[model samples]
Target: MVAMPEPSAPLSLRHRLAQNLRRLRLERQWSQEDLAERSGLHHNQISMIERARSSVGIDIVEKLMAALGVRASDLLD
Candidate 1:
């Protein structure tokens, strides 16, 4: 199993993105499949992103932002 980071430890950009993505998705009442369909990505891709198991390119980020009706900064910061 993968180890989880300590709560006190600062998250890396990838992990921060993952956390924010999941939060935003949930706030919108969307499942991974829903996000994937809206983003034109596969559900597996969304899962990987939410888990921080995949490094996303700017194009993918743009897709997600558009699908989620959020800005790039919302996902990053």
Candidate 2:
């Protein structure tokens, strides 16, 4: 299981999502542009998401999950 953040310093959901997204992408040796192409999102959008600068919707999340070959729980957990 993944470890949780400490009570004294909790990570926001957006931040966690960004970190997880970046991690998974890197694990696949995929660049932002690569992920963008696979996910049908703009590279800028992928950058914004990896930087936690955009509010992502369920549709976007689904696209990303599909492109990454991961389940929602994999991203969310």
RMSD values for the candidates in order, in angstroms, are 1.0, 5.2
**Tens-digit lDDT string for candidate 1 (1-77):** 34558899988888888999999999999999999999999999999889988999999999999999999999998
Question: What would the C-alpha RMSD of candidate 2 be, to one decimal place?
Answer: 5.2
Clashing pairs in 2: none
Q: Write the per-residue lDDT of candidate 2 for residues 9-58, one digit (tens) a residue.
A: 97778777888999999999999999999999999999988887888999
How many clashes in each structure? 0, 0
The CA lDDT of each predicted structure is 0.93, 0.90
| Worst-scoring 10-residue span by lDDT in model 2 | 1-10
Stretches off by above 4 angstroms in model 2 are 1-8
Per-residue lDDT value at 50 in model 1: 91
User: For model 1, which pairs clash?
Assistant: none
Model 1 poorest 10 in a row by lDDT: 1-10
> What TM-score against the true fold does each predicted structure earn?
0.93, 0.87
Best by lDDT: 1
